[model samples]
Target chain A: SQTIHQWPATLVQPVGSPLSLECTVEGTSNPNLYWYRQAAGRGLQLLFYSVGIGQISSEVPQNLSASRPQDRQFILSSKKLLLSDSGFYLCAYERQGAPHEQFFGPGTRLTVL
Target chain B: QQQVKQSPQSLIVQKGGIPIINCAYENTAFDYFPWYQQFPGKGPALLIAIRPDVSEKKEGRFTISFNKSAKQFSLHIMDSQPGDSATYFCAASQITNFGNEKLTFGTGTRLTIIP
Candidate 1:
């Protein structure tokens, strides 16, 4: 069985501060990773997705960016956060050829002050 | 053209009652449709999914009714439980350019089961 892990279950940051969220998947190799954000009372919006290491495709251009540093490790970062950046961030993974089923991590709650 | 329109942003139902949620899409290229359930602060979990070729699929207490010609799909819950109270999201995806599939989600329907 494969498991996905996300760090800093909850975070509180002020505007202009930097942000970093990490996601790691175990028991899978060369999986497709994705980053999604959900605002209060809104559906999820895809932020970024990666096919392989050092390859990322952004769906919505924003202050946030994503990186695949390792095969199973993905990181979402921002040099300076904005008030609009506050939301629930999720990490998801799917097998390379199998894009139908996407498994999600617990998720990180970010609050910008 | 990439939107999946969902109706009844919120629904309230009594325990043991059946709750139905509907969604429609505009993109003909979309071949996969999935429904997710999310608790208050947890990530959305894959509840059920259906392909265009199938008209209906049932798993446990959940069922999905799909209409390919109408470009619409719906989720049905049988003998609903209070534990099923959560926000339901409907999403559609189509394989575009190099096996990369991007999903477009609906506005989400918040389902409340009153006990």
Candidate 2:
């Protein structure tokens, strides 16, 4: 069975501070990874997605960036966080071929003050 | 442009009642339609999905009805329970130029089950 892990489960960052959120998937290789953000009572917004190492496609332009440093490791980072960055960040993974059912991690709740 | 649009931003249903959520897409190339359920403070989980080739698919108490010509789909939850109360999201996706998949999500609908 594959499992996805994300941390820290909750984060409180001051405005203009740096941000780093990590996601790792065990028991799967070369999986497609994605980052999504959801505001309270709103739909999810796709931020970035990575097909392979060093390859990332950003959907919306914002204060955040994503990187696939390793095959099973993905990181979401920000140089200086903004107040608008506060939301629930989720990391998901899917297989390479057909029937791509995405599996999500526990997610991180980011609060910027 | 919002590729997918979901209706009834919020729904309240009684236990054992059927709750339906609808979604419509603008892109014809979208071949996959998926519904996700998310609890508070938790990540969204894949609940059910359907391909364009199929008109309907069922899994346990959940069902997805797809209309190819109208580019519309819906999720039906039978005998809803309080545990089923959560936010539901409908999404559409197609194969990208790089062979990767990208999903466009609709505005989520919050479902509350009244016991």
For each candidate, what's the DockQ?
0.70, 0.71
DockQ of 1: 0.70
Fill in the DockQ of model 2.
0.71
Off by over 4 Å in 2: none
Candidate 1 C-alpha lDDT tens digits along A1-113: 89999989999999999999999999989998999999866688889988889999988879999999999999999999999999999999988777788889999999999
lDDT of 2: 0.92
- Candidate 2 on B13-102: residue-level lDDT in tens? 999999999999999888789999998888999999999999999999999999998989999999999999999999998887778778
Candidate 1 Cα errors over 4 Å, as ranges: none
For candidate 2, the TM-score is 0.96
Angstrom error of the Cα, residue B18, model 2: value is 0.6
For model 2, what fraction of the real interface contacts is kept?
Answer: 0.70
Show pairs that collide, candidate 2: none
